[model samples]
Target: MYSEKLKYYEFFAGVGMARAGLGGDWQCLFANDSDQLKRQSYSDNWAGEAFDSRDVAEVETTDLDGVADLAWASFPCQDLSQAGSKAGIGEADGTSVTRSGAVWPFLRIIRGLAEEGRHPALLALENVVGLLSANSGNDFRSLCGALNEIGYRFGAIVADASHFVPQSRPRVFIVAIRREVSIPAALRTELPQSPWHPQTLLRAHAGLSVEDMAAWVWWSPGAPPPQKDFELEDIVDLSDDADWNSEEATQRLIGMMSELQLNRLAAAKAEARLMIGSLYLRMRPNGDDRNVQRAEIAFGATLGCLRTPKGGASRPRIIVVEGERVRTRLLTVAEAARLMGLEEDFVLPETYHECFRLIGDGVVPAVVRFLADRLLEPLAKHAKEGVFTTINGRKLA
Candidate 1:
């Protein structure tokens, strides 16, 4: 094994979801978050005492002198968020200079490492899509400038959880390698070329500038995963004796539906009772074929991006019903853990609200595994090949 285990430090460690995604293949050496409750939750799941509830900006590099190989930070994205106030800009020290400059504190960690000549070999960052356009590119430019100053080479990609699971959460991931190490020229060249070079509109109100736009590269959607023709039969979780009477639910659903949709539901309900032994909510995705996946089950299909504010519980879980005797409930958190490729045994928080909130704000474990197996592994191997021995050994001062 190149490493018996890769060691990592997790910043903004929310309930240790990233650690859950990585599994036990790697060891977490240091983790920090400001939330006392989240810190306790992180401790409950992982075997470590490194959970420090401190403002990350206040964390000094000397405090983490010989800790880990990689550093992961899923910083707060509210300032650059599309759904929230698009506050931008922070002071040089990274305190939100404006009402919405949360990213600065995140960047400050890297800046501090650069000053101390103790930056990690690998840095993985996650954020919202709005970051691509925040502050007319000033925020991003400053970030790039910081990394450049610290001798790091960075690349970014936007991936949706739906690629691996059924959730369509598109997030921006920025991966960086210490500059002394040789980044695979081939890897850079092989990245899918993008044609959708849209200017990121950070604020609905901000002026457009030439450099504020990011050229988005497109990847051919991967092969669709196999699916069973099992309708609601395979996953429904109602008790054997549970009653299905919900006139109020029916009425409310009807009330919420548009007139056209209400008509369809009424017709479908009536048609099923008259003709078939079973009533099914038949659904299919756009341009779907019999050979294609059952693209119609709204819940199983790609879910919309999970938002921090609109937690998993706030949303109604979806259910697919086929007949008087068949129905599948929206995925439970345990099932969601499986889709995220998390270990079934991983402990979750007891608080219902916290559990959903943490999951919503988490990095998909599969995504982290991909970064570890596909990206970080290669970088680590290349570094061990003596690509940056001189660079790595030099002190920043």
Candidate 2:
């Protein structure tokens, strides 16, 4: 019965990155997002099949297609983001506010489907790592409680995009399974795993209610294969026409750097090869205790994380240092797409705001593929075949 291609639903689907990550092997039965521009981008790329453009809050059980094996939701992170309001997810009674509140509707949909006996076998919710300690850990507990009320057992793993791409985006993925489903012991851990389950997550688990703690799972997706031997130069274009800031502007930016940052830039200049780095504007207290906007330079094996470009501070700047030369420019749309591990031919939104935000707010398809190929698919197969027992680490047929 599980021989057919496993199917999924993409909730909070931004530009269908989840669909892309799931690839052609897994069938995407439906995709939903409230943002119209994101939907337009998805439509252009996906031919507008099985998509709901309305807010998830407005979506009901009847709006979805038939039951799916998995449901993926990369809900908005504004409220839960450490960089944002830090408002948390609010009370779990469905009175969610701001974008972070989107999770409420997402959970509501799952409950709605469950009421009709159409809930997915697995639920994967992706959010910023801040969700681990939001509201002194109460938010995380509430989130799990909501899932428990809907008849699911949940665990989480924190995965960073830098493992697969030239960008540093650490996100938390909470995977919930219907209680009746039997998880393959090989795919779970008796305790939190290193790197995937950090101290904050451990603390959050410690805070769960007795019943919820009993229902908690410790997922073991396993380590992904070694990353590609790629660098910033591979994803970024530095040609003359690629919007490099003028020499004067570049010098002004350099001047804004503190002594420590300039020292870092000088160290980069000493390198033999042309190196690319990211620069951002931050407000720091000047000598007189007044806040002054300063340009901070960051360089490493990967670029900094991508964020929605709502203002100058939110938009990232690329810094190129080849010997004595220093140039800076806003990150390009194509570059942002590449950072998110999108295909070269992927159709991006017409405007930068829509295109950049979609990528920033979306999941890395490569990371999704890693999770699906490693744990999700195998878990689904085991559950469907009714392989409820494992003897000496082998499945019983």
CA lDDT, every model vs. true structure: 0.56, 0.84
Q: Write the per-residue lDDT of candidate 2 for residues 260-310, one digit (tens) a residue.
A: 899999999999579899998878889997988889988788898888754
339-397: candidate 1 lDDT, tens digit per residue: 45456677776555556666666778776766566666666656655534433366321
lDDT computed for candidate 1: 0.56
Which residue runs does candidate 1 get wrong by more than 4 Å? 80-83, 88-102, 135-138, 190-245, 259-300, 310-316, 321-332, 390-397
Among the numbered candidates, top lDDT falls to 2
TM-score, every prediction: 0.73, 0.92
